[model samples]
Target: MLLVFVLILIVVGLASGMLGSLVGIGGGMVIVPSLLYLGLFSISPLFSEVTPQVAVGTSLLVILVIGLSSTFAYLKQKTVDYKSGWMLFIGSGPGAIVGAWLNRFLSSEQFSLYFGIFIICIAILMMVRNYLKPVVIRKTFLYTAIGDNGDEVTYGYNVPVMLVISFSIGILAGLFGIGGGVLMVPVMILLFNFPTRIAVATSMLVIFLSAITGSITHMVLGNINWTYAGCLVVGAWFGAKIGAYLNNKLKAEYVLAIFRFVLLFVGIGLTIN
Candidate 1:
């Protein structure tokens, strides 16, 4: 039974890591709910009775691994925007601390309900993102990158505005163990006119930094399950590499379409369960 449970967790980690890296979400969206569902059912005696706090903390730990793996892979491709990622982390770091503190207040039921609704909202946003016009904000920073086809792509953002947005997203990351990229990717592409690949790559960097702070807070709170975390890390480490490789091959629009569907399905399942 213990072996079976470990295998199950590893599989979950693989899926979560692959999806997380591909989309820059750090795999927490999948990990949190999986932990909750397994705990709710008492799937294994070795790690039974997983609470929301533990689930979130454990997810964040796993996310740390996923982020590191994915970011390393992205760096090799020269897709990451390090300056922007660090700038965004300034706000997200403090916000993550606040969010981790806030997580102590939620019950399992509350966490599930809120997480479900939040995921559904994000799914809806993904669906409509292409149709929505980018908000016109004065640029305080500009960046240029060479595309796969050698065309120069330019993007820019207002630093203050982006910091505020990153802070808000960071709070969500810490609270839900989601790594913040679910929202950040869309915001970069739609709001800041970033190329899809660059946004995805850069989002991983921010997610990595935010996960460090968020996981540290959870560790201080004793919310982590080291046994489970270890198993997840093993799978996620390799899965992230696979995902990063695939990200370069896949079309952004197609990947997002599938991601939206998965989010909606998972959201509805989490809500009703």
Candidate 2:
């Protein structure tokens, strides 16, 4: 059983990490929901007891490791914006602690229902971004927290705005065990007017910090499955690297489309199930 779970973690981890890196979204977008659905009784006949909430928690636990590992890779390339990274940390760090604590008070059914809705919303948002359509209401705020990592220029927009948004991102990270990239990347591009490259790079840096904070908290609560986490990450490492390799070859719009498709499928599955 342990071995089986380990394999699942690695496979899922690799896919989630790699695809996430390519798209500037956190792996949790893929990891959390997939695990939630898979844990549901409907996903597999044998694993009915695995509730969606457990899957969300478990997915968060594994992605913590993936975030740490991904951080090293980004840092190695000198691509991380340490300044912006810290700003987001400063804003969101406290909220994350609070959010993690709140998770204990919530039930699995609540997490599942909320999580499904969140995914569906995210999918729609990604589509809007890809099309360059006027975004009706982006809850995302601004943080003039661009990292100064060499000549690769990225503008920091409205510092005051960013501070507010940054805090919110932190809370989400803590509560959801995400790096807030799903929310961050879009805001960075739309609000800050950053190019695709900088936004993606920035998202990775933010994910590293938020994910580490979240994973440590989860580990303490004993919600993480080491064996399973390892299994999922086996694939995560390679997939992220591959995504990074292909980043220049791909466009953000196309990546967003894929995310939309994945979310739609998952959303439909939830409705039918």
Candidate 3:
């Protein structure tokens, strides 16, 4: 029975990591919903009583593992932007802690509803930006970074703008049990003028910080289920490597389209579930 459950977790992790690395949404969105469903179905006696908080905490641990796993691939490709990644990380840690603390006040249903709404809003915004007239810009060349495929990646960003985004997204990440890559990736591409690939890679690094910090808070709150997390993490490690490799072959537009679709799907499912 234990082996069967572990095998099931591995399959779930593989699918989550593949989609996460491809679109920068992170594994939490996948893990949370799936785990909840598994709990309802009594897939395992351990999962039969799984609560939203436990699922969220366990998901964060899995994402932390996935982020670390995927980051190695991004690093080898030189796709991870260390400087900008650190900047975002600096702002994310505190926000994540605050979000974790805030989570205690909201009921599980409230959290699910709010997160569902947030996901839908993000999906709509991504699609609208694609079709809408150019949003007015206040831009400055922030810095330069080298990408994996020898692309010259320039950073055109407003420091204040990015800082705010980093902090806010961190809060959302913690509150929703997501790693915030879904929001961060798009913001980096649209607002900072980063290439889609660079944004995806950078988002991994940011997620690393957000997930770890949030996981720590969840741990303190006794929210994490180590048995589930351990199984998920092992599979996520291998899956992340595979996902990162596949990401290199995809086009930017396709990645964005898939990301939007995933968001919409997750949002509606959470709301109705």
Candidate 4:
């Protein structure tokens, strides 16, 4: 029974890691909802009674490990912006702690409902952005960054705005055990005027930072399920590699489209479950 449960977790991790790496979402979106659904019925004595908080915490723990693999892949591609990543990380670190603290108060049903609504909102936003004609947004030249292919890409962003956004991202990470990449990726492209690929890569780095802090807090709070997380991590390691490769291979529009589909699917699943 234990081995069967472990295998199931690994399969979940593989899917989560692949999607997370491709979209910079840190797999929390999938992990949290999936675990919650799994918790509906006891699969085995070794993996019974998976509470919402425990699922969230364990997802964050797995994300911490998955983030490293994703980050390294992005690093090798040279898509990561260290300066921006560091700034975001600074804000996210403390925010994660606060989020974890807040998570203590929510009931399982509340968590599921709210998280479902949030995902639905995000999905709608992405759909609008993708389908609607481009609306001109004001932007200034921030600087140029080296791209993965060794080309210089110029971008701009409002720092004061991003500071607040990054902080909020941390809170989301802690609260939902999500890497906050779903929100960050869109904001980076829309608000910061970053390229889609760059936003995805940089978001992965920030996810790593936030996930580490969030996971630690969850651990201290006794929210993590070590056996489950361990199994997921084993599969995530390999899945991340595949995801990174696919990220580089696929076009930006395709990536966004895929993300949109997943968001819609997961959001509805949570809402109805």
Candidate 5:
């Protein structure tokens, strides 16, 4: 029974890591809900004691693994915009701290209800992601990168606006244990004119940094389950690598379309449960 529980967690970690890396959302969207479901169903004695805070804390730790693994792969591909990633982290890091502190206030029912609503909203937003127009701004902080076709693509952002947006996303990340990439990726593409692939890669960097701060707070709060975290890390490490490789091969639009449906189904399930 112990072995079976461990295997179940590993498989959950693999799926969460693969999806998190592919989308840059930090796998918390899958992890938190999965842990909750397991606990709610009493799948194992270990999981039966799971709470929202514990689930979020455990998920954040796994997200750190996902972020590190994916970021390393993106670095080798030279797709990561390090400057932008660092700048975004400036806001997200502090916000993550605040969010982690706030998570202690929520009950399990509140957490589930809020998370379900958030996921549904994100799914709706993703449906219209491609249709949105990029906001045109003067190139104040310009960046140039080679596109998939080997053409030079230039992008830029307003630092103040970017910082503010990142801070808001960071709070949500800490509060929900998401990496905030679901929102950040679209914000980069639509508001900053970032290439899709670049946004996804760079988002991982920011997620990695924010997860560090968020997880630390959770750790201090005694929310983490080390045994569960260790099992998830083992699977997430390999899963992130596989996801990063596939990100280069697959069309993100198609992948996200499928993912949106999954989120919708999961969201509705959570809401009704």
Candidate 6:
């Protein structure tokens, strides 16, 4: 059963990482929902009795690995930018530590309610943002919007705009034990009017900080299920590479369409389940 559970997570990790790489959503969204479906693990409370809080804590541990592998893979692609990514990390790190402690103070019901709220909004926002925009390739690179044609286009906005985005996304990410890429992706799209590819790559860069922040706090809480975490990382690494490759190969709509659906499914499933 333990091995089976690990296998399930590995598969989930691969799918989430690949989609995440292409869409800029991170693996934690999938991790939390799937873990909830899983109930809980070999801990003392048994599966059903283990509170949602504990499940979240455990999921954070696994997501840490998923986020790390994804981030590193994206970085190698030069998709992970250092300047904005670093600042975002600074803010997220402390937020994650504090949020984990706060969760410990909350009751199980409180945790579930908060989690539900977190899941719902992001889901709706993700679908709306992706669906409305037409995917175009551009060579904006670090500037903002992507340029598929030789006519390079860049958003007029600057780093401060991105800074605000980092902080807002960081808080929820800390609370939810996610990379916060869902929120980040849309913000990049609207705030900077960035293209899907840049948005996806940039979101992964931010995940490096956000997930690390959340994961460290979960670790301090001493709730990680390491066995599962290891398997998740192994699968996610390869998955991210494949996703990155596909990201370069596929059209923007192809990735975003699937990405949006995954978020929708995850968001609704978490709320209803």
Q: Kindly list the per-residue Cα lDDT of model 5 for residues 1-273, writing each as its tens digit.
A: 678878888998998888888877778888888888766556555556789899898888899999999999999998899999999999999998898999999998888889899999999999988788888866569988876567888888998898899999999999998888999998998898787789899999999999999999999999998878888888898888888898998876777888899999999987887
Model 2 stretches astray by more than 4 angstroms? 1-8, 40-54, 76-78, 131-154, 271-273
Clashes of each: 0, 16, 0, 0, 0, 6
lDDT of 6: 0.64
TM-score of each model, in listed order: 0.95, 0.80, 0.89, 0.90, 0.95, 0.80
Residue 241, model 6: lDDT of: 71
In model 6, how large is the Cα lDDT of residue 135?
A: 35
Off by over 4 Å in 3: 1-4, 43-45, 132-141, 145-153, 252-259
Instruction: Give the TM-score comparing model 4 with the true structure, all chains together.
Output: 0.90
- lDDT ranking, best first: 1, 5, 4, 3, 2, 6
lDDT against the true structure, each candidate = 0.88, 0.65, 0.80, 0.82, 0.88, 0.64
Predicted candidate 4 versus true structure: per-residue lDDT over 102-126, tens digit per residue: 9989997788778888898888887
Q: Residue 126 error for model 1, in Å?
A: 1.5
Q: Which is the winner by TM-score between candidate 2 and candidate 3?
A: 3
Better of 2 and 4 by lDDT: 4
TM-score of 5: 0.95
Per residue, candidate 6 scores C-alpha lDDT tens digits across 177-238 of 67777777776666656555666776777676666667677777775656556666777777
Tell me which of candidates 1 and 3 scores higher on lDDT: 1
Q: Which ten residues in a row have the lowest lDDT in candidate 4?
A: 132-141
Model 4 bad stretches (over 4 Å):
131-141, 146-152, 252-259
Error of 4 at 54 (Å): 0.7
